[model samples]
Target: MKAEFATAERAVTLGVRETTDGLKMSMRRQVTSAGLGQRMANTWRGDNYPKGQNSIRAAGVVYTKASRIMEGFEDAAVIRSKDGWWLAIPTPNAPKRGVGGKRINPSNFPEHTYGRLRFVYRSGKPSLLVVDNARASYNRKSGQLRGFRKASDRAVSKGSGLTTVVMFWLVPQVQLPRLITFNTEAKRWFDRLPQLILKNWPD
Candidate 1:
């Protein structure tokens, strides 16, 4: 599968098409693998890699560790794709309509009829919102954001204070079954949400 994080203004796409594709994704991230960051590294076109590398070194880390990171977000997680690509596709402006996917911020966000993605983070950790819309545009983008600066209570833990959260609304391609609480004690995150939003959002 592929992961796209797009915004009306900007978008970043990441994919793991296959074993070979993972390299492609890493290449898009930084391109330091084959010394693309240096003189020995270069792409078919005439693009100059700022980091001075031909492969994204971090992606390898991401692939080996994406599931570990998702342990607190989904019942199961894995990196699977074929193209192995990554990019930030720019857009004209904010989406004409916001990502109203199901099992999302129902109180604040429009009803999500399609798909949604949720990830976890500690209080103050870096976070983002990734989007890849197939009905409108089937591409991956991960830059900017997909929701509010402050995450709604719909997806937070019971009594958990406001913290960092990354979202990815994969309309028609949501990975998670539903929003869930992170079990810090068990060191596991499970999917157990109501079919509809709770009438009273417990603070």
Candidate 2:
């Protein structure tokens, strides 16, 4: 009688599935670890960014979708939607919420969030908030901003009048240090698929 062995096709399939599940779980865990988020957050909170620009560090880097936006002080750190997973830093181009809960375009944010923006100068100079080519004046007596309005011909004719409006953006610049850190590490995990399957194979 010829010696034969039963086919192990079902066992092989099961092994593959189990290894896949394990690897997926491991990847998820690695990506969502608090340590990873904290590391990314440190990068943002630190002064290492270009020209010492203050970055967002409210939550550092989180794993959830950007749709679950977080508001920190007057700044916001939002994530953008991607295929599997991704993260974003608060960029100067980040959108702002206008009246009636409308999403104001980044370029138009200066106009939309006009009243909320504040302008301060370290030196002895007039610091005025300008929005949408209009200067915002505050009513000191009422403790309320008068809002934006077009400068009249008389106002425009004055040379020193323009200097009174110190226009600047209020949005924070979003960065993605996590992308740089996680991409290579995640690839390494994916490359170990074969070894993972074999190591997890049934005895």
Candidate 3:
């Protein structure tokens, strides 16, 4: 007599689906633990280190709006101005973004609000946009300069405790350092994928 074996096709399919779900869950947990979520939030909101939302997962892919920034931290990258002009690196004295997220530059800076900005050239060094006779406003608790106070005509004429404040530093390019071990972190989680699948195996 001969014996024949039949495959449990439905059970096999269910097992595979369960394993996939578990792997996805594990990946989401690992990504959250990596602190990328907070980084993305900070980048988007222009805030200093706050709790962030979870990463977006779609069709078996994980990503975020700050993905390019995260990738830049994986390796040294050079950033330059898009207009072939000097990059305007903001200083403590620079005004914050204007209405509608418009960048405060020399051309568009609200002169009425912060006084006129003057350009200062330096030999073999980055140039600067400065405000004369202006005082910097600082946070009382943090002591961080928020913006420059527009100096009155009287103050400029009298030079009454007046000071020059650097608003923006103009540079051709800036180099970013490798700040994150992206591949290493991903590999650490990837190596454990088999375990994740096994743990999720259907009963």
Candidate 4:
């Protein structure tokens, strides 16, 4: 939500011999960067998707700090640091009692909803791949304990008949990233720039 820019010194080869038309490449770079930033921002906002885009559909860690995109020009982008971990977890709505009124363990539930976690990094170094259950819920307000849910105190249950049960617990679920789509969209945005700049260029 805030406008922030992080400068990344990338080696750019304009790919053309020196000429009076160097402006074309420079314009291309700027437009490309802006396009990429907008695409990434849209993804973060969960736009341009259909059918339960907000649903948590898998269990496990899908993203970490290292996987974060590090820089953008007009929108906020993740800054690389040895200080925190970002995790994606999938959680389902709730589960009901099975046969014989037996309480099902939350772990056995098929996770179809997703959320994310941000963890504070400790020690002189931090890891991007270290996943420990004890450390996973290291956040003070993560997960559930006893009969208390950290996210919501109200108990809600779904389903009816012999499948009715109370909604309980939250756990990690995973969501896949659309890196390919990001690249495609970014390229499409960038592809239109030449004509745009030519139209704006002085006669």
Residue ranges of candidate 1 with Cα displaced over 4 Å: 1-114, 122-124, 129-203
Q: lDDT, candidate 1, residue 138?
A: 23
Per-model TM-score on C-alpha atoms: 0.15, 0.31, 0.64, 0.22
lDDT of 3 by residue, 156-200 (tens): 788876788888899999987676554564455556545554553
lDDT per model, in order?
Answer: 0.28, 0.38, 0.60, 0.28
Residue 56's C-alpha lDDT in candidate 1?
Answer: 24
Q: Least accurate stretch of 10 residues (summed lDDT) in model 4?
A: 5-14
Q: Tens digit of lDDT per residue, candidate 2, span 123-161? A: 443333333234545798996865444455576566333
Candidate 3 accuracy as TM-score: 0.64
- Lowest summed lDDT over 10 consecutive residues: which window, candidate 2? 52-61
Model 2: runs farther than 4 Å from truth?
1-8, 34-96, 100-175, 179-183, 199-202
Best by TM-score: 3
Backbone collision count in every prediction? 43, 10, 0, 9
Q: Residue by residue across 1-203, what tens digits does model 1's lDDT show? A: 12211221011111111222333243333334423343222231122222233222212122222334334233544343233422111123223345453333322333243234333233543332332231232225655334333334453444344342223322212243322222331121111111111211222
The Cα error of candidate 3 at residue 178, in Å, is 1.7
**Which of the predicted structures, 3 or 4, would earn the higher TM-score when compared with the native?**
3
Candidate 4 lDDT by residue in tens digits, 18-43: 11123333333444455544443333
**Lowest-sum lDDT 10-residue window in model 1:** 8-17
Q: Note the residue pairs that clash in candidate 2.
A: 41-60, 66-79, 89-174, 89-175, 90-173, 90-174, 91-172, 91-173, 91-174, 92-173
